[model samples]
Target chain A: MLRAAGDWTTASIGDAERAIANVVRQARGVKQLNIAGLGQLDTNGAMLLLETAELAGEGQAVALTGVRDEHRRLLEVIAAASVRHTDAPDDGNPVLRVLAEVGETALKLAREGVELLSFSGAATMAIVGLALRPWRIRWRGLVTQLQATGLNALPIVGLLNFLIGVVLAYQSANQLSKFGAELLTVDSVGVGVLRELGVLITAIIVAGRSGSAFTAQIGSMRVNQEIDAMQTIGLDPIEVLCAPRIMALMITLPLLVFFADVMAILGGAVASMFALDITLTQFAKQLQAAVSINHFWVGIVKAPVMAVMIATIGCFHGLKVSSNAASVGQRTTQSVVQSVFFVIAVDAIFSIFFLIIDV
Target chain B: MTSDIPASTHPLAIHVRGLRTQFGSHVVHDDLELAVRRGEVLGIVGGSGTGKSVLLRTIIGLNRPAAGEIEVLGHLTGTGGAAAAKAIRRRWGVLFQDGALFSSLTVAENVEAPLREHSNLSPRLRREVAELKVALVGLPPDANDKYPAELSGGMRKRAGIARALALDPDILFLDEPTAGLDPIGASNFDLLIADLQKSLGLTVVMITHDLDSLYAICDRVAVLIDKKTRIDTIPELMKINHPWIQEYFGGPRGRAAIASAERAGAAV
Candidate 1:
């Protein structure tokens, strides 16, 4: 016989559990729990006692002696509840499970790729249709988005490019100074900033900043049922939401890239003045001689393409958000990552094309 | 657990005196006083902007009243030390309007969270207790593995109740527990609450607009009027002369709820 006596409420369950553990270990052949001395009983205590009885009886049902009416009811409820089956513990081979996960992830990526392509096509068609019918375009949304995605982004973009320009010039000067060819630092900084780094860095920053913002904005709207409301009201979410953002990004990206080029070159000039004993006038002259307008144009040409990829991917993921708050966060993160990957891939393709064409 | 504490010796579960709550110059509640007895379900009802939720929030220490003395389970809430407040919080559980389950954790893990934080129970035992609580709340066995997003509204609320009962709390606070559920689901929820309260011997404070729930489960109704509380039984409250109180319990929906409650009583 096991006599359980204590306030078995949550407050004292910790101590009671310790004491019960000792009793259950010793009562190997016990078949009865006498709870007549049990003071206060709750679900937690009832569960603990039920477990104790099971462990003591070694998987057999242990009968209780002197159970009160209320304790009887409580124990019956807990006993029935304790019999529920939860998820089975995983005993599968780790290797096979990992392989399965890898394959599932790959399939998910491929499906997402196809969906994103279709969404891009739909958005492109909408933008083209709106461009042709200029009067039907939402000028207010365009202006608002342009200010939000462009004007607000200028300072961060400018500051980062300028800092990158300084770092590049300093690194180049360090290399060129070994051979007393420090004058060529101007050539390297001007050409690198105008041809590759300027637009690449700008596109990456915009992808992280505006791209994630687009996804989060649209994703939350999806979560809130605002997208469904818009559709029910006969408004095309693509036209009203996606088009303005894509159009504004397309218009601002090239201008931002141009701004980035100017800021980075200015930064390179300042670094050269400090590191290479070169004056601003000489730096300007060398930059003019080394970097041509086509290098600047090469960088500018990738801007609108990157903008389209980034904005479309962001909006696509946003539209794909399921009706939950977590989905909004997950989609937003995916949008930023995909947009950055595509920006670098498209930039590589542009570089190869430019190399083959010798432009 | 404290040596100085007298466990369950107090007659009142919650005591509030001179509670004055304001947002800027707009007063939501002023000089509000209330006392809740132990082991009783009290329903708080009010019209829009009458501070039903505000009073609950203030009492729970979510929103501190501008001036008030709020005591819950014999502990002075919001004015106590961190350890004291935590002890008080452990003795009670709150269910928000929505389940407010952590979106990242599954239902089983959501139920285990408090145990993981507060108890020294083994991992297996904690899991068992969480599953038992889930079962106790009438959620399916499979729901233990599912996320809150995957569950229906009613199921999510059930999961919320399971989490609230995770510690076998002395008091359960529910805010708008059946607001969005269908009529049948709401009645079932009322029954579930009534059953849990009886079995667990919990003191329940519920803020609800459901007259049926008030009529069916609440032992006493606390009506929020003129920024103060008028506490009475439903039948006694119905006989009061306040216009809002009259329109509330004597209204069509209120009458229907009372009629249904009477029928249920008759059947029982």
Candidate 2:
């Protein structure tokens, strides 16, 4: 195979085929005909080769060469694979066509992934620059965002956690009654609230809410070249931009998680009071007794880790934003998905580490 | 001592020598040398992507130059991360091509952006400074309360200029100051610049393609070519036989220059 150079110009298949036919006609005694230096082929070249080869009456043959990667891939597109029969023009393999389309789709996906990776790399460089200078926080921006992310997120987090506890208490009671182990329901409610639901729900919420918001905010800045402006004004975009968000989330998320856990347990207590006629005093005692410090800390630790992951991933995606409206959506969605995925992955890693340590 | 000016005349506003900025394989500026005196207007005219913006950006540390020495307002040239540039930012102001005022803020708040960022001045002071600029630019008092979206094209451009002038900078850089404005509005901006230069002793550097603008107010002009300052002096530009420059100031654009010269001759 002859390698196509950068300046290679594509020829139509018909033209190449005509050239091939002329070459074949000229060289009457040659056994094997190889065409090279045509560089890359379009359909006009490919089809001409197929047709001319099919029509070789006596002792002439030609094999097409010098197909570039893209040319070969396009030929694999089923249009010029050469027909099975001259009798039926319509009876080409349908599966091959479908497979070609699938291949093209896969290529598109690969291209998009590469594009995203490059963008992420650019932002990573900018963030690294900011990280080198730690004291560049825009305090007002930080305060405003913190109030929005933390103080404003409180009521929803509180109510959601409280209700989650109620569900856990009621559900555990339902299963326990069959085995006459209703007391175990208290342990289940306590464990679930303190050790799992609280952290998971808060992470999901933060991932959904704050993650997208960060992406939008930074994405808009990214689009506006405000991030570039920051750089120009002797400010590290990441330190003035990313570090604050990351720090705020780290500080706030744990508190939110702790609140969510307490509220969920309270929810469970309320359900216990209604279902089992257990007094708030008795419910509180059972919750405290059933939940070990280990269990509480397990979920509590996940909060800060999850928070860091969320804020970092969100800011990372935001900084990756391109100079348009579409990249804003793309980065915001990517940020949310990536943050949630990272939070879950980190949570699992921590859970296993804790288990390995016998914590 | 240069032949154009006496030995005692020192250009205090900006002194740039051998400024070269390259991005990857593209050299945006190469060996660009320019000096604009205090209380002078230097209009830089170049087509799009010719490093007009890059030159202004490099001087103020918005874009990093690969090799150069730029002294603006008695400070060394620093790139996007230059601390010296930050310290000198209050003394220099820039009006972007698109105004580029923060969309979230009202006109008054937008004008106060630099002041608010760099100063510990109270709200009242910021407000007073904002009001002064607004009035100086001839924007109505009510224009301050309106968002950027509420303003027309000329209004936005004026607001942007007002913001640039908020700190009463020693050197002001404007990128396409009157681009997309009506003829009358453009002339109005030019007259305003002339008035400001006279009253404030302000040194102005404007990047524009408008011939009327250059003739109307600019004390001198620098022409950029191939992303570099091809001709630093206007007479040197006349002697140079570059196609675009000749076409720009000779073929069609020469009419304006000839007319302006005739007007000067008639006045004499």
TM-score of chain A of 2: 0.65
**lDDT string, candidate 2, A1-359, tens digits:** 11222222243442344555676565445333344444555565555544444454344444445554666665566354666565656746899989988999999769866765665465456546556755545566678778878888999889888888888888888888899887777789888777788999888898898988988998887786566544533456666677678777878899899889888887887898898888889877876786788899888988987887788778877887887999999889988988888788887898789889988
* Candidate 1 A-chain TM-score: 0.93
lDDT of 1 at A189: 91
Report lDDT (Cα) of residue A303, candidate 1.
98
lDDT of 1 by residue, A213-251 (tens): 999988877775456434322246899789999999999
Model 2: residue A187 alpha-carbon error in angstroms: 1.9
DockQ of each: 0.01, 0.20
TM-score of 1: 0.58
The residue-by-residue lDDT of candidate 2 on B1-268, one tens digit each, is 1112122345567888888889899888878888887888988987778888778878877667888798775556564454445667767677776677677679898787777667768999899989999999889999999998799988888888898888777778888888898888988988888898788888999999888787778778888886556534455676788888877777657677668757965997
Can you give the TM-score per candidate against the true fold? 0.58, 0.69
